[model samples]
Target: MHITVYGDTLCAQVTATAMAQTGHQVLWCLVEPESREQLAKGRPLFREQGLDLLFADQLESGRLTMDFWEGNPQGLTDAVFLALQPGQHGLAAELTKSLASSTSTGCGVIVNQTTGPVGSAELLRDIAKQIDPRAFLVALPDLIQEGNAFQTFTRPDSILLGCEDGEGEALVRELLRPFNRRKDVIQVMSLREAEFAKLAISGILATRISYMNDMASLSESLGVDIDVVRVAMGADPRIGEAYLYPGCGFGGPGLSSNVLALVDALNERAAEPGLLERVLRTNERQKEVLFRKFWQFHQGSVAGKKVALWGVAFKPGTHRVDNAPALKVIEALWAQGVKVTAHDPRALADLGQWAQGRGELTLCDDPYEAAEGADALMLITEWKPYWSPDWQRLKRVMREPLILDGRNIYEPAFVREQGLVYRGIGR
Candidate 1:
């Protein structure tokens, strides 16, 4: 199969490389010249766990190629996947129009991998029908996680294919056959249903996280451990415990955005808002949990203090800090006349860009270096390296041995035994 993926997002790069690795000819049409030049020189614009090697292998094998999107991109392949971001729906519509106007006589499938609002597929189909009625439009919402994207793409739990006709469904299923080896993993549905399903899944995930965070807050007030309650809840057959861990908050490009998108959709259709509105409010408050804890621990004053942050990324295994809790905590601390030293294995460079022109923030290459001379240490992201540290060295370096375990990765009793003050989410 010959396929063309349009966009420069992580989804686009992963789809193009994965398809080429599976023996398909893939043309990755980047959105700009900067991305094209980066890929042309064997450099990836974004970071993923093993995507660099897969991209290099595919490029060297001649199965995958790159080019910038200029104008009409029709007739380049039998299928065109619009892998643009949520805000790029206008570009997607224009590409559909160009493909429909092309002189190609054969049928083509337009796969909507972008997370657009409902009715977007219908809009694309209507535009494509103006030039060629045979152009098939399908909405295939992506379910890729940021840190573990390649594995998720190659072994997805299920694939949703949104098409109105059998031809489009057949073409998409064939294209995804390599990844659907374990069973019949494709779920066929209407275009609107597919679009809504993606948002629905994200909504449920956000609800679970916010629900747990709410419970964690209650547990703290009642002097109960949320971890014990979480374990017992997971043991039940009805609730198999995923996304149940209470942390500072949930942050990424997709999860919260999808929840808000659903909220907007529901609000437009109904007379009043729904429970998802509260879910968004809860998450926003949770993102400030660490900062609030730090302020209270210091008796409502963090002035002239130095704080050490262990991780800056929203989650481990990637350098994305779009809405990370670490950013919020850092900003709050800085505003109160506090200096912050942060270190993450991968997120330092990105965080440096985000923290530019901020005089109080320092980016450190080593976690211990960040801890040196700091008043308190806060663990923001639960990266593997931050799980267990040399407690003796940490105590020796810090001016104050106060530890704010944002992720609850350390034991309270154990840290107390070591003569270090420990605070967790709900312990």
Candidate 2:
């Protein structure tokens, strides 16, 4: 079981480390030179929980090795995994061609975990087959959830495997046997179906979130608690609670890009305007819900005001802020001449980098420090540390005791009892 994994994505890291942990010798070919340099220095490239330690252990035990993507795999490689980022289709094709060219017998089963448009895997397979007819390409579309990526990969609820050939399916199944132990959760399908299924899953989840945000808006006008309505909706066995929370909005590399890809696919197919289009529009508007609340609370005279943001990461348990709602919120606040101070446990460094030349942003180590003398406090990411805070201290430090709960993590009545004005997405 000698596997070579390509790309510097979290999927690449997780796949390499997990396969090594399962007794396979894995050579991780990182696409980014910086990632290889950091790995050589024993520094973690990703901040996923427990991933660094496990990856380190595998490296120490000689089970996992790191190399650059520009380098060829040493000796005969049994399998290849491409976990590249979206828009790396050319790179994927190049890698498949190189592997196929180098292999005298076959390139083996090339598993594509990369996120790309439909038919991408088939295209790679066609390229590989030109060099070696035995070379097989399969699609194992990435379903890794950030923040909890390692656990989700090691124990996925189900795996979408796209393999047209019996031998390819058998090879990939053996490679993933350790993770697929619980009741055989692997759903076999055509390559195009597998890719489309992943995008459809993301689309539906985004749709649910946008739908909830839409309901939250209506709930506010009706003076009804969206949380209550959410609970009632979840009580239905048919609905089953998941991605139904009425937050400011949903943003991350995965959901946003997949929805956009789905939209593009629909458009290319000459489909009419539909739910997904509305879903994206609603989400964009929802990202500004907190900003609108602040402006309305101040009667539209919010220039030169100070606001504190509790979290900036797209979600809790990860340090990435790609397409995070906090960015939009910060931009809106800055346009209104509002000073923004933010605090997040792990995302400050990333947030600082993102804020470069965008506008003035004060990053604070402590949550209360961010809130100091601020007119309002906006909870953007709903990190666990921000769940329970020093209410009295927040009340004392802020110039105006205003709390805008974007994620509905705080109880509105309890926040008001602390003598602070509370404004949630829909309380």
Candidate 3:
């Protein structure tokens, strides 16, 4: 099937590659001319582990192709998947209008791969119906994670497709025929149900992170080790183990927005249990976990302090810094007139734009370079480089060798033996 995708920015690129990998031809329409130019020059738009490899394969195979459209002037496909962001949260309507105008229309499955809450699908379904009642618009939302979207595409465990009727359902199954297998996870459900399930899952995961952070705080004051608590909690067969490894907090594209949106929607409905409310509150407090610990240790004022920050991205293995706790803490430090030098393995571009005109902030290649002449060091992301560092060399470079390990990826005795004040989350 020669399908035309609206946006081939990042996830769209992955989606197109995934489709083309299965022998289907993909005509990816980028949002901007510059983006097309970048692709033409072979410059990648974003970073991911296995994306570049797949992209190279598809490009060579001629199955994946790129084009730039000034506007969606009108074309058609067997189906259209709106894998777009909530730019003013109005791109859905715009795509629907363009889809209506497309001359070669037919009975196809329009999948909503964008991450959004309930009611977005119903609204899109209504819009598609306005265009052609026969054509089906379903919310076969993508549950892809950052740094792991390609892996999820190649080997998805479950696929929840929401549709208005069986027509959309059957087409969706055919669309994802390459992935569906025995004990098929292609669950067919109502549009509303599937829509909310995505948000609900994210909400629950974020809540788990925040809840762990909350425990970490209590552990600090009560003289109990949160790591011990985590081990005990995960020991339960019913509980299992996942996001219970206590850290600073949860921060990323999907989790942050999804949680906040869920909280707002649930608040408006007045039917939300108090648990969701607490989750949002806890997460908000959780983002400040590292900073709060720093403040208390440094008395009331952090002024004139030279802080070394490790990890700029929200999490390791990716360069997305949307709601990273590292940025938040850096801003707070700047506001209080504290000097900060930060380092990351891969988030230089995002951090560079963020540090514009801020002469105090330095984005360093070497983590230890940032540590030089610093009062304290804060590990915001669990980058593998940070897990094992030359602590003795680090101690020699810094003025005051106090360490704050936010991700809890360090050994206590070893750090102490290195003659450093090592503080960590929970334990």
Backbone clash count for every predicted candidate, in the order shown? 0, 0, 0
Kindly list the per-residue Cα lDDT of model 2 for residues 149-243, writing each as its tens digit: 99999999989999998999999999999998877999999999999999999999999999999899999899899999999999999998998
Off-target runs (Cα >4 Å) in candidate 3 are 32-43, 73-76, 87-89, 105-107, 271-274, 357-359
Question: After best superposition, candidate 1 residue 99: deviation in angstroms?
Answer: 1.1
TM-score of each: 0.96, 0.97, 0.92
Per-residue lDDT of model 1, residues 1-427, tens digit only:
7889998788898999999999999899888777877768875677877987898899999999988888867345888889987878898898888877777533368898988899898899899987787778999898899888899999999788888979989888888999999998889999999999999999999999999999999999999999999999999989988988998998888887899899999999989879899998998899889888888988987899899999999888888898888888888888889989999988888898888886567889999999999889999999999988989899999999999998999999999888899999988
**Residue-wise lDDT of candidate 3 within 1-427, one digit each (tens)?**
7666766546687788888898887777777666767668876877887887888899899998877756563254676777776442377677776676566654266777776667887887788778777657788766877767788876788888887788777777887888876558787788888878888888888878878888888898899888889999999998868889888777777778877778878788786465777976777666776777778788857888889999988887778788888877888788888898899888877888777886568778888899999988999998887888998999999998889888889987789998999899988
Candidate 2 residue runs with Cα over 4 Å from true position: 34-43, 71-74, 104-106
The candidates, ranked best first by lDDT, are 2, 1, 3
The weakest ten consecutive residues by lDDT in model 2 span: 67-76
Q: What RMSD value applies to candidate 1?
A: 1.6
The lDDT per prediction is 0.88, 0.91, 0.79
Q: Better model by TM-score, 2 or 3?
A: 2
**In candidate 3, which residue pairs get closer than 3 Å at backbone N, Cα or C atoms, i.e. clash?**
none
What RMSD does model 3 have? 2.4
The number of residue pairs in model 1 that clash at the backbone is 0
